[model samples]
Target: MEEREITIVKGKRSTPFSRGILAQTLSQAGAKPELAHRIASEVRAELLAEQRYTVEEEEVLARVRDKLIKKDALVVERLDKWRILRESTEPIVVLIGGATGVGTSTLAADVARRLNIQSVIGTDSIREVLRHAISPDLVPALHKSSYAIKPEDIRIPVKEENTTLYGFRIQASQVAVGVEAIVDRGLKEGTNLVIEGVHLVPEIILDRYRDHPNVCSLVVYLSDEAAHRSRFYIRALGTAMRRPAEEYIAHFGEIRQIHDYIVESARRMGVHTVENFSIENSSDAAVEIVANRVSGIAEKAARRPSSLLLDASARGG
Candidate 1:
């Protein structure tokens, strides 16, 4: 017997139902990946047993919801919220800020994949572009690593701020120009983006967009010094030793200083901070924060009067 393929219909579109796609969606909405795959497989089996060849998207969602609620109600709520975020009119922007070796870039990529965001950029790339346009002599801090600013390159001498922080701020402030431009372009084009790097200092790049409904920012940090150092070794291996871990380890003090500064700034600014000891745990925490932020925006929009919503939409909010 030739088995029939299940077709899912949504509005004017019809596509083949895929357990892999459903599982990915479920995993993205806060469900454990293994459990998500199990649930997806079960859903497929149920449909096959019922001999249902055609189904509405809502029906599939309802079935998945029923199954998901039995195993975990919280994740089911997140799945609903994820759908709301998808239906939102504004583009999503996520800024991930952290010290070097704390895994901001890795977390940013993971979060982008979970949310299906197409644009992923790093602040380092922005800094590189700035280096080409600006002369090292003109802005010495811009040319050095955020954590490796030479004493002579320290242009700002704030009495209260330490030399390490002062140098980082000088470099980050210059990079902030590029970060802001990318953010503005994403907003204008309604393109979702994930921008992560040490240069995304909350006070520098986040202050302007922090209040925007579609913009969510968070900091990732490693609280334990030993674990933080280990990340550099792991990164070096991953990069085929092209970026020597010894170089980063040699400057661990400066890196940890910047780490503390960023973490403190996050706390002061009321931005969420994820202690990144484990990738899986940190990823869940990061995704939950983003989901909550998006869901809150969706709820507020839902409560507004249609006229106000329309007015806000027309104004490109």
Candidate 2:
């Protein structure tokens, strides 16, 4: 009559039944933690009533789906997505890129919080760090604002749009070295990070993580120039004490040029783009883009799995 007397048959072998696996599958399907546990508890009773020593893995899957169908019809797709999220062993890296005033900082913060990731870094912070380590005499671009960098240093002809693009790209390249280093370290440590900043351009990030299934890159932009300019106005009013937002306002044209350049590069390179017309829409789009990219942990851990197997000590939370 003891619990250990029951076994679940799985592909030519049987093991002591554990509801941990059931709860995990249900949780991945979008069941809340408490509900997942309650569902698993109820299902275990149903399985025992069969009065069999072993139940097929396929049968278990069927029962799990049935329970979900009764709970809510909409969760089927959510379940499929969660299944991949549950099974993937790799850390998730989300890189968000945008021009100075496109609101990516806010979007990235929300997405990171929603994803439950602990690391959120702004590339502007990276630029500030580089300024301390490198001298202006060595890297003049590092010392000047990307838009305000004197044309005397630029080798290219100073066409208005091209001039700004060229200047920003130079500063971006210098900052990119630090960004890539952080990414490399995170990959080795198996820690997830959400890095948001202007320097996370499609051109640079694509080179580093395009082939990496665990990393997703996104570029945010605003189609309406007037609205984009308004963002700078609102920002200036709030932080009037420290830095004058008017400088950004005065250089708005140059900022838009860089924004366009980045968007074009993202399109050419096939990096995902989210337009920040509204915060809710942009945030929802960003999360879905990431969820779509994460492969199932269960699928990858299925073959003689160690950590992902049905061990009660393993935390599915």
Candidate 3:
């Protein structure tokens, strides 16, 4: 027998319920993989058993919330926070940074997916574009790898800072101009974006937008040197040796030095830092951090007086 399709009514539109999408949403809201799928299956089964041909989206949400609240209240809270973020009209901007081999690109993609952000750019891409526009002689730092910066790469040096960090900083600052321009365009155009790269030293880009509720920034690092070293091999293998592990390994000391500098900067600036132990654990932490930041903004907006709220809304705050 052909099964009856369950339709979910949202506003004036209706569509068939999807267990996969529901489960993915649950997972994005901090549910475990197994638990999210199980909950999705259970919700579908319950709806079918009840013979509900058509149900409001609110009913579906209530059912899911009931299931999650009984199992994990925190997950339910995350669900609500995500809902607030999703419903907000403001553009969300996520900035992720890490030294080489720390998986910032991977985590940035994961976080962007979970947040339903459509635009993802890398600082490396920004640097590449800048390289074409400007000459290496004019900006020598832009031509070198962030981890393997030499004294010659930096045209000017900062007093007291080591040549390595100073060169990295100079390169990063040059790229920061492009990064900030992209960020400004995103904010003006109201586009959600996730930008990640080695050059996104939290202090440079993050500090400027730290007070903005819709903006979130964090750094990812691998604390264990062995694990950090092994990731280059794993990454190389995954890429079919397009990015050879040996080259990165040869400069591993310099890469690790840059890693330490970024981590130290993050700590000193009170920025969020996620240790890249495992993707699942780190993704969860990253999502939670975003939820916390956005939720605070939503909550503060809620508490504001109506007149003040209207004024803030008019000013696009």
Q: Over the full model, what C-alpha lDDT does candidate 2 score relative to the true structure?
A: 0.75
Lowest summed-lDDT stretch of 10 residues in model 3? 304-313
What tens-digit string does per-residue lDDT give for candidate 2 at 1-317? 56535666655555676777667655544456687787778877887776766777667666767877887655556655544554456777889999989999889887765455678999989999999999887777777776677666565568764667777888899999999899888878877889998888889665579878778899999999999989987877776536677888888878888899889999999999999988767876787778777654425644333222245344331
Q: What TM-score goes with each of the models?
A: 0.91, 0.70, 0.91
Tens-digit per-residue lDDT, 1-317, candidate 3 = 98999988766666678887778778878899899889989989999999998988788889889999999899998888877776566677889999989999999989887777778899999999999999998988888888777776765655534877888888899999999999989989878899999998977777788788778889999999999999998998787766589999998988998999899889988789999899988988998898888776665543322111112113221
User: What TM-score would candidate 2 get against the native?
Assistant: 0.70
**Which residue pairs in candidate 2 collide?**
84-296, 87-296, 87-297, 87-298, 88-296, 88-297
lDDT, model 1: 0.83
Candidate 3: give the clashing pairs. Answer: none
Off by over 4 Å in 2: 1-87, 155-161, 237-241, 296-317
- Total backbone clashes of candidate 1, pairs 3 or more residues apart or in separate chains: 0
Task: Please identify model 1 stretches exceeding 4 Å from their true place.
Answer: 155-161, 299-317
